[model samples]
Target: MLPSTYLPSVNRLAPPSDPSLEERYGSLHIRLLYHFEHDFYHHTKSLHPGLKDMLALFMNVGFATPYLMDELLAYSAAHKSILGQQTSQLYLSEATRLQTRALTLYNSASPQISKDTCLPMFLFSSLLSQHVIYNVSSNVHNGLGPILDGLTNSTIIHRGLVAIAKASWPMFSEQVQQQLIRSCQRDYMPIPSSADSRGECEVLLSRLNATDMKPESIAVLRSAVENLQDRFDAICTDSSHAMWAAVQDWLVAIPAGYLELLNQRRPEALVVLSHFAVLLYRVAEQWFVGDLGIRLIRLINSHLGPAWEDWLEWPNRATMEQL
Candidate 1:
């Protein structure tokens, strides 16, 4: 956990020619910038080719906007945390403050959204969402379903992306527009064949012989699992920057009734969610999901143990195979 000390705004203001203040302010940005470019940027570049262009645009926007720069620093700091650096906790605390300041600026702005602020807002939202996902995924001891609270941040990111696309598409240069299109194109993909998923789900569902189970509840969970399978296929096929956004939306995208049943701790719901855990396994190579899939399955087993072992047979087998 990061300490609550406040970092002064020495850097956010114009240089006062005070050597110490300048050094303190300038060094933070310089260090974070180096980390972003040389370390974080290169690692994420392969996530999507068009992300390279988006990052360039983000840098241009960040340099001009102090609040946005704060967000960028925070994001880079969070990225460093993901890399297992020892100084990450301090950086994480500062990242929280910086993100708060950026949001404060946006909220206090005039009613009419300015074109000047649009780019920063969009990039900040996107980067913040990425930071939250990466942060939560890397800290698995906190668990999965609860970590999904970060989805609200992701929702803001998606809305910001949509707003920018609708309002500013015509304003950017042809080169930038082409890059944006390529980035957007990578987000959506055809759903893959469902034969394997269906087979897997059927095998898992067949283990449930509890006569006391509600048929409607079972149906809802079944649908949810099937929906997760579809999403998993879509994510596997997608080669876009938007893929992470979709992954974040997974919880909300499923039927609400399905989630509610899970809240009730329906055994069938747990079984299906276990399979959703498997989807996480399939995408574990993606930094955004990381080892979360394996952890989620383990957590599920811990919660629903030997008594529910029959329901977990397929999921446990799948998880073991992944190991």
Candidate 2:
């Protein structure tokens, strides 16, 4: 095994206070915020003001709704798991129960989804998306199989976000309104690949056979890979947690046809997607992605084989050479 120092400090991120030994988790909410959310904000500096406000509402609102609270707990537990806490499974179990309660409330509570209700719905959905990532990443059998599943969760969450922002942007504070607008622009989000990796991406992209696919499809796929590369660059500059969130956002924002191609296991599509596996492998030490990245690289190789090995040359080396 490689020395732990070679990896990102994601797992070493500790919460602010000790967890409650209380079986009832009476301090669960406070612990969740102080430990997980605070640490995350400190490291990433990129979490939205809207989310920050929702968390505050979860604490102070007299009517601190069930779904909102449940999502908070689920997010906290999942974050704990990612940080390598020994009690991750225990926290995950509690998170699962709370998520179920949150979903039930969501099903029963919504005809109005208006300004008064939209923020909570948006926050709950966003947190649930993160929770799903933690859950899928932690499972032994999950590996590469959950890539699309995680992407699907992110896509649904993004749709909800767009709808909510359209109706409720007026309701948020001016700062939050600006933040939402910025997110809509997507220009300010961190780039995935670093300057050093640009050459690698160019090399990979150049190998694609344009004759085999339509120009439109090629354009879409090329855009997706470039964005992925940009995200890889961001990961190196920012905390892995922050950039991973951006990546999740990227998955949802990518052209819908990207997923369609992935579903078809098109070689060109997989080749581009394989680059993301290399990015994921960078954080393999974190409980979030675990060995899934390594598995994904292998899966890609198996799918493409020696015939297309040249296309995978950089990514295969990336996965193998990691510490």
Candidate 3:
């Protein structure tokens, strides 16, 4: 349990003065800086045994904030002194690698480009990976159904629904496709007890029967259902890596709807979507990496925007002692 007192202050650490560090390190340096400041290193150690490795790999990418780095290094030194030498050496090596690659990639880009191209891909990959980890874990806990219920009411869900509607090809089996149409027709319902029970799918069907669904909405529902089904199928079939891959695909798909909701200035939708993102990220990291789940944790903390710093603060001493 972290203390509540430790708010995530703005990253006050200056970038390395050396222009070479900037050229060589690229966005990876920023990532490392962001993560380290958020105390990912400490959190990774606290995760369940199953999630540690994935967390470590995330950390290895060296995305951290300066404040987080100070805490991480201090925590590591105080509690795991013997591992300090090895950890420091590893951090330095990875940082050096990132810097060199960043410089090379930047130099090759056209002068007209204003931003680092690699940054988007790297960030996307990291976020996608984390989202996958979270989805798998939530599914295992039976949490996704409720989360989806929340999303169904969201404006973003509307956009996603619209996207699905616009697709030219059918994305799901006829039966499933119809079921989704019905589900979105009425007020959303809870998940059924079993395949035979009256589940959300059944509620959807009831809604459709009550009203004529817009052909466009039908198309949108069809697309969303199909996309979801494909992911579900992958999860069911691929025993070795299905979990990771399916979750990644799902996260990648989220921004389409998410951005739409954001554009509409729907705060409730944003809250739900953000929760979905955080939950998915946590579960994904837990399932794939075990104890080292902190990497994604840190990434999420940073990406949640400025407010997360305050959220990451340490608890009072009494509260800490109680834990």
Give residue 58's lDDT in candidate 3 (0 to 100). Answer: 33
Task: List TM-scores for all candidates, in order.
Answer: 0.72, 0.68, 0.30
- Give per-residue CA lDDT, model 2, range 1-323, as digits (tens): 21111111211211122333233236765676575557655543453434455445544431366657656776766666556568767776666665555554565565355656666655565566555556556653644546655544445555555555466667776865565455433324445334455565777667653446888888878888777766655544444555455566566667878877877778888888778777667655444566766777787787678998888888888776642
Spell out the clash pairs found in candidate 1: 186-240
RMSD of each: 7.6, 9.8, 16.7
- Sort by lDDT, best first: 1, 2, 3
lDDT of 1 by residue, 117-178 (tens): 55565566566556655655655687645544333333344444455545655666587778
TM-score of 2: 0.68
lDDT per residue for candidate 3 within 1-323, as digits (tens), equals 11111111112111232334343334544545455434454655443232344344334433442222322232222222223576655554453333233323323332221132222223222332232232232233333333333233232223322332334115444653454344323222332234434121333333334445455444444343344334444333323234434444454454444444434533323333332343233343343333222232333344455653333332111122222
Q: Best candidate per TM-score, number?
A: 1
Of the two candidates 1 and 3, the one with more favorable TM-score, higher being better, is 1
- Weakest ten-residue segment in model 2 by summed lDDT: 2-11
Runs of candidate 1 exceeding 4 Å displacement: 1-26, 110-117, 143-145, 148-174, 184-189, 192-200, 204-223, 235-252, 259-270, 321-323
Going through the candidates in the order shown, the clash numbers are 1, 12, 53
Candidate order by decreasing TM-score:
1, 2, 3
Q: lDDT (CA) for every model shown? A: 0.61, 0.60, 0.34
